[model samples]
Target: MTEPVPAASAPSGGCPAHADVLPLYGPRFLRNPSELYREMRQEHGPVVPVLLEGDVPAWFVIGYREVHHVLSHPEVFARDCRRWNQWDDIPPDWPLRPFVGYQPSTLFAEGDEHRRRAGAISNGLFAVDQFDLRLRSERIADDLIDAFAGRGEAELMAEYAHPLPLLALAGIFGMPEEETPGLLRDMMTTVNGDEGALDAYQGICATMERLVAHRREQPGPDFVTRMLNDPANLTEEELIADLVLVMTAAQQPMAYWIGNTIRLMLTDDRFSLNLAGGRRSVGHALNEVLWEDTPTQNYLGRWAARPVLLGGQQIDAGDLLVLGLAAANGDPRVRPASDTPALGNQAMMSFSYGEHRCTYPAPELAEVICQAAVEVLLDRLPDLLLAVDPEDLEWSPSVWMRGLVGLPVGFTPV
Candidate 1:
């Protein structure tokens, strides 16, 4: 493990001047981030000094090994956002506040507490039967496909990919079918960080609170009930916070995983050639998406515990570090050329890594949901083809997530 330098205690050889820091947002980054990542790597090496929305300074960890090191050694790069040195400058209405703000959820927990909270989450997810999950996912996918099969043309993003995971989550969370629509609405808004995002966040929290209360009165064979019954004995408040985390975590990224995989199959000859035949190719496309266009491109992340030397750059105590997951996966030292197929390579930083990574069975369950969604969609619409030019596909504009705004496709009518 690398040690953090003492805070200004040693002679300071400055790294990059604050003025030279790259801006992480704007049209350039949103247009083609892969090219930008390559430029940053060449100019700044592994770690780049960058500015966020308000020109807030932070370090973007773009190296494969560098991201792995930061995630592995939480002692050097901590999760608790209260340690951030720039909070005073952050405005009350900052759009990024919802992400970096300290919450009671497991996302910012540390040490034994993180283990306890995260362990309970793992147990709850593990309680889910994989066979049952696959069946339910297939049912959800079929139902979604049925709604549009007769039309012969549909936007996969809004019509299929976005709704499948949220509907599946509703079943897992023991939500009444009638309420699933509203839950989906709020989750989509919150996850996209839209205009009403904060309100949507509050609404989702309220819904989770109600679900937790209902489960307390009448426990069921669901993820929430399992968490409530876990030996960790989480308080209602803790349960609500964590449930919100689980809900948000499950929806947007899972949707993108499905959408991106579908986009890959439609555009790439390798997977498109095998789409209607074997399941093995779907698995390959899913793995490829994680490496190339992961839903979470960058995570607003770990704060320095003290001054640290990472990727030959001096990081000050309380400075924020953004984990560039997509960039790390693209590192040529560890991965093949971006244009080359990364077949059979599953070592991507897409789901992140180490303690704070998506816990145990959660990743497995996610794969179950994704695979079922992809296979069932292809099985239902074997003739599916992109309705628009590949160049016309617009991605969601957030720096954090990588997903298409919509994926229009045409197929033979049922």
Candidate 2:
């Protein structure tokens, strides 16, 4: 377990100008948080607490070393309700207040309860070699590309990244293919938006209820059914919640990872040429791409468990702390050679680390992106380049899932 690292320069807390907010999520930067983050890292320096959503307080910790400290001490820096900022919108009777009643996913859970659940679920990915589902992953990757190959070109993220991981979850749950579209739609609406997220969440909750109900009568060796069958592991509600957590685990990041990596390579002719050949260094390019830009802007919040001096500033037990994975990944202290082109994996901060680490198969995810998506794009579309000039493409205005809104490429139909 990595311990929280003190900010070498320390944090300067409290509200940044409201004017700065627009640029942070403005029409231009939302499409690419990295550009905003890079600019902010230069302007804001390191740690700064900006009151957001009209006075919901949060400390946006930007330094890589500082982010490590906060996540490593998750026992001290809790991920539960204490960190939530539910400013003016709380009805005393609301069943699931964003701050208090929410249990987002197992990744953010704290204490014995977190261990009770996380320990059980971690088995599927990291435990006793009980499930080596590698071949299944390769099969899915090949099939996805095979479906799109005849088109001569496709939007790799939508055609592949977005649906594939969700299908991996479906495959894990033994769900049928017909459910994939709805499941994909369900996840996209639920996770990406800040507005209407609560309503979108209700749809996901209802979908989970039905999925759970469907599985009870037709139990199997899938992740959900396995958890359902194990009385020691999951209660009914917990099983449903856990499925929501697991399904969302690597969904968007992997999608953005696929898109971002391809974008990075193709835009930079040097990397593009390396990728076109499908060398061993494709692994390196994947590493470099992840380090170059991560998908999510703000990390899921972690709270101060008790009073502590962070960055030499006093933080109360319940104060909210946000580790800017987007910022930290690019922080030169952690990555002095971040801008330098290299294939070495010095641990990209994209999926995050520590107790609240990513639940999906990222290495496999990277392999799939390279093996199927990136290679196919290069080999198939030799003449198929970005539809517009690289500078002309537009990006989604999302703080969390940064990707091109549309990548219209003019290609010869080979």
> For residues 247-276, what per-residue lDDT tens digits would candidate 2 score against the true structure?
665566666766766677677766767654
**Candidate lDDT values, in order:** 0.87, 0.62
lDDT of 2 at 217: 84
Total clashing pairs in model 1: 0
Candidate 2 wrongly placed segments (more than 4 Å): 1-24, 38-45, 83-101, 126-148, 151-153, 360-371, 376-383
Colliding pairs, model 2: 4-69, 5-69, 30-397, 30-398, 31-396, 31-397, 284-343, 387-409
> 379 in model 1: Cα distance from truth in Å?
0.6
Task: For each candidate, give its TM-score against the true structure.
Answer: 0.94, 0.82
Candidate 1 lDDT, 1-414, residue by residue in tens: 322211111112322344467777776656778778888888789999887776667789999999999999999999999999888777876778778989998999999999999999999998889999999999999999999899999999999888899888888889878767788899877767788878888888989988888888988999999999999989888899999998888889999999999999999899888877878999989999998889989998999999989998989999899999999999998875677777887789988999999888888889999999999999988999999998899999888899999999999999
Model 1 residue 267 CA deviation in Å: 0.7
